[model samples]
Target chain A: MANEPDIQSDSLLTVEQAIANLQGADLGLRVYAAWWLGRFRVDAPEAISVLIAALEDEDDRTEVGGYPLRRNAARALGKLSDRRAVSALVQALGCSDFYVREAAAQSLEQLGDRSCIPVLIRLLNDQVPGTLPAPEPPQLAQPFDAILEALGGLGAVDAIPLIVPFLDHFIPRVQYAAARAMYQLTPSPQANHYGDRLVKALANDDLQLRRAVLADLGAIGYLPAAETIAQTLAENSLKLIALKGLLETQLQHTTPPNLSQGAIKVMTLMDELL
Target chain B: MTDSLVSLIRAVEDADSSNRLLEAVENLAAARLEGAIPTLISALSYNNPGAAVAAVDGLIHLGETAVPFLLEQLDAHNYTARAWAIRALAGIGDPRGLVTLLGVATADFALSVRRAAARGLGMMKWHWFPDNLLEIAQAEALEALLFVAQQDEEWVVRYSAVTGLESLGLAIVQAHPDWRSQIQSQFEQIALNDDSWAVRARVWMAQQRLQTESIVQPRLEEQPSPLSETDWQMIIEKLYDRKGQERLVFAEGDPRRYRELVVAIAQNPKPV
Candidate 1:
């Protein structure tokens, strides 16, 4: 009797117990079992399939369910980094329920597959942002910001093309995510080469490009480009970016007065232009 | 003994801004007050839809406190409030509140709130919402048909502010004042400069107005849209508006991960 722990463990077929608990008439108990199994990823493949089936359960209409089982599914998939789950997660995007859709979007992001970029990009066009339905009473207090982090973490190189376009979003948050994805996809030479092209682009035919390039050069903080930038600041329509860049670059360097040639040249140009 | 009841009817018939008067009704829902209830119910007689809404909203808030008193208003002179009383019972949302909200939602007036009450009736998920009405295809709202919800009339409504479909009507009526003068003259600006195409189109169709500019051409703004590829670079700079450790998380985002761009730059600080 004292050493009967093994018998106790044997008496309870744990996976069956978890699945049975997951099916309790009590919604909260069922959700808890699903959540624990999903998070621990210890569920039998049959149990994983059970949790997945529960994703479509009407927890939405139930007042007592701890979470819609779909979140548990997504979290489980993310924990497992199970590549097989990607298609199912992507399919969840169309769930009439908004929160479920958000979870699906987030799970796909967590998977961080190069294939998911097109899907993530496709979501950017979802101008009507929230898909999460209004939960029945005791509305969720803290809204989820999980998808942003998940997308940022995916760090898939293929996301570069898809994510780059959204960087110009009217809302800064969207652009911030795109910027984050950028560093993950293309870090070193892209930055250096991209910076070089930008400096060269200051001479582009398009005035807007030229103006933008001046600002880009400023952001690069490259000392060699400062003299050329100073020359362009003189009587260039792109003067403001040049002037700002020159000032910012000077500050970045903390140059001694003797090395003030770049700042001095830009100032003389500004006086002439003004 | 005082002025005949008919004259009391005449004065309340001319009141305005039904939406606010309706708001006034909400405050009275739990209050034991009686004066505002009758005034609001009396406004129901007015041709003004706003005044009628005030009456319904007022009665729903009055709950049991004003119910018996209001029963007389519905029973008299084929009064509109009687019909509205049943519908308002539905909007109150609570089952106990049902007798009142339903009184308003189904009330047979041509007013907008009455329709909202009916739809509200169908949406109630509890034992309260009847399954029978669920099959009743939602009657198209007069608010939608007349585009009253979209009316830019007065500063009270505008094209940009509306979140739902009703704004389409507001935009239409805004540009076309003959439809509803409640909107301002700047309806033209809404058509010409507003961000939403649906709003602009509604206003244009309502006024039967057109601008030569196609959707492809953005109307001129005080500032230009970002056009150059490097404009994206400007956007990135703005993201890190402040420098140093404050932007460390921003700098470390995937773009700057193991090959931390900000760190690399800081270590080899350029002598610009």
Candidate 2:
């Protein structure tokens, strides 16, 4: 029985069963189990321990499609958001597989641990400095965006200089990510004071640029920009996002001042139009 | 800062071995080094599929920077070089390449080149550009894709054209509303009548996707667990036994190997 594969309803396995399956010989079972444990997120020490342990399981020697078990484990650990998995996730950053490294970085972001800052910064720096402007391919894993977003989530102030250059990157995704990360790292209401590249980007003719900047301003809760964003509602190209930013600003604002009131008016108007 | 990349560019030029040339192209593209565009364009002509794929990826990575260089290669004396250049440009999806792709998709001598062009026509990534031109370009692109889908000789080319047809409509059908009929007619025609099984199958999937678009709320982000608190607790106890080392074996015919179970595990039930 010990050697007989524990093949529970592959998706419905109990956390204990899934953890045990993580140690199983069949590669697919291990991958499935790791994913299940993460989905369960039972908040058990044993579940996290097994996921971290699975990170070192390179035993699946099949070359086709690469070994996905470890990658799945890393992703599961991220979903679990256990601080205990931080060191393991950080180590997985250097894994040879792009998916594994991506999974590790994304998990670190989800974990929201500031301790992962140095590693995230290092990974961001390692990316090819400049690439042409393009949307991130739907299926491609974007390590640069993952790293920058992690740094921003962690609020690494020192990473601002590193994140700044990417603001002008030709890749629209990278440019948008750089703006968002900078917004996260900079103190709110003071984003414009810190060179506010997103604000600077608002001057560009690119509608995507305006939309991304508006989203970031709203996300960062930069209340001062609410009025400016509201002004764009007259332009059909920018109206929907302009309204979204105003709504976000209104909701996230702690202060009930003219800015908040104006946001309310704009949001109500947008709602009525809708 | 680009010193190492400069050395790689020289290596690509001077390398005696094909393997070295390919490696140099990979390094240049990975690093996204300056002056790697011409080298990547030249490497596309190589017989090696690995190197050719890498070159295409490299040129695409270079984005608009490689557009002019790629366009220039259409006039190259070598036909193989011209074909590869079309593929690279197609992969890049620049609006500048649209006319060239249309021309090649219809008249290119090589069937491979025409197929590549057809595939490129489908992959225009129109949203990447400024919005003012989107409506015009989308209309033009759809017309061209339909032309290829209806008239292309090779089943492979038509298959690719069908994909383009689907892509051109998927996004705007909901918002424009008027596009719904045209998209339905095109996709339904191919889904029911396309001769090749592969083409018919792809068209069928596209048709289904279009039919369901309005009913299904497109999922933008991962959601929480849909399993009830009781169900979650039940699954938890059964799976969370830390002391147990042996794995649970699902019977061979277990019904849990389906998407519904995953949805139950992964998605949160909405509040009534």
Candidate 3:
């Protein structure tokens, strides 16, 4: 009933090798190996079924792949977009490992089929809204952020309902991610709320967070953000990268003369600040 | 500090997100990632409690290399520094921590802090204390063991002390059985309650060791097979009294698989 071409396991040897070796070793070894194999599944559809089995393993050390692997497997399975795998991934959000739960969230975004939007919106709140005390010494929390990125890349327009409120986060990373995700889900009425904050970030004195914000804006190509980009380009203090990006987009699509004119206004302001 | 470490520590202060920087440093220490000792020591003095806590964990992870640093902190002004050092030394199973732990157990510190020191000393006994651990368990540590045995407010400390006492041959209770039973009955509250995660985890570990020890033994209890009659009949007859005819018998099958054979009838029995 199904096509044979979609069922190949040969490309998934990395996952199989990971599984075979993991299930055979000591508990700690099994966990480390399982995590790596699960990461391989994120890009390989053949790994979805195997990952589902890993989730059912009762031994926490044997089953848990930590955050990197679990999240990717979830996202990867979602990318496969098989409706049957959705609930299994949902159950995985309850895996004992915090990172695995985070990964499950991101994978739901990759599926982008709309049915997962509600659960994901719930998770974004739990993970980002300071509901959980941060783990001691802050380990890299990539999965939740990765999920937000996936939602944007997959153009999950339904996500705007959840993504908008997080832009008000006191933590710059969460606010920056929410703003960027909102921009990617384009045409949402609430994009203005997030977009305005991004414009403010562009003017903030902290250069690193500021640069990260501009990069996201440039990536999203919000023509409304053209003013922010134009402002950065005219200042000798600001990097040429943001301006180059805005000018490139405008030149490629709109008339170049209009951008040059906008650049003139930003230059006049720069002259005053000096 | 190495450039990468200084950069990461700086990043910890300046980071928009403290997540990865903290993890990298901690993992490096936990694996006893060598040559990272100096870096982690500097981080212990960081302004942020979170960063310092993270650094302390890294130091704990470094284990023995942190001993000198831990020893130095035994006299520090910072309560947090002293507290974390006690925890790290205990976690590393270092015997040097015992004196400080013994001192702090009686010191007028916060109950949590005192409980932490007592628990750390107990943890060291299991993981790295000297052979006198069992001796210490039997003699000088009874009151503290009893305190941890019943009254400590924290379960990690309480369970650790109880389990350590149990592992050291149960001498605290064994030296006097009736008193020991009473102690066990009192602490049965923990073994059965199932309320605290720390208690449950330690219980699981303790029970696993108990089960393993009981089921394994050092020697295989089996006897070797006697020599076949055909191989040494005369030699056997010379050693035995009045059973010369019965001393020899023969079978022609594999000895290990089909080894049964009947000896010859006794000549004395036949004559009588």
* Predicted complex 2: DockQ: 0.01
Candidate 2: list runs displaced more than 4 Å: A1-274, B128-132, B174-176, B212-272
Tens digits of per-residue lDDT for model 3 on B40-130?
A: 6655554333445566667766666677777887687765556656666656555455555655654524443464555555454332221
The deviation in Å at residue B216 for candidate 3 is 87
Q: Rank the candidates by DockQ, best first.
A: 2, 1, 3
lDDT by residue for model 1 (A101-148), tens: 667766676566656645554454453343444365334211122333
Docking class of 1: incorrect
What TM-score do all the candidates reach, one by one?
Answer: 0.29, 0.38, 0.34
Task: Report the error of model 3 at residue B240, Å.
Answer: 98
By descending TM-score, how would the candidates be arranged? 2, 3, 1
Candidate 2 chain B, run of 10 with poorest lDDT: B236-245
lDDT of 1 at B66: 52
Best by TM-score: 2
Model 3 spans with C-alpha error above 4 angstroms: A1-16, A26-46, A57-72, A75-84, A124-133, A137-163, A185-193, A199-215, A218-274, B1-272
Worst 10 residues of 1 chain B by lDDT: B133-142
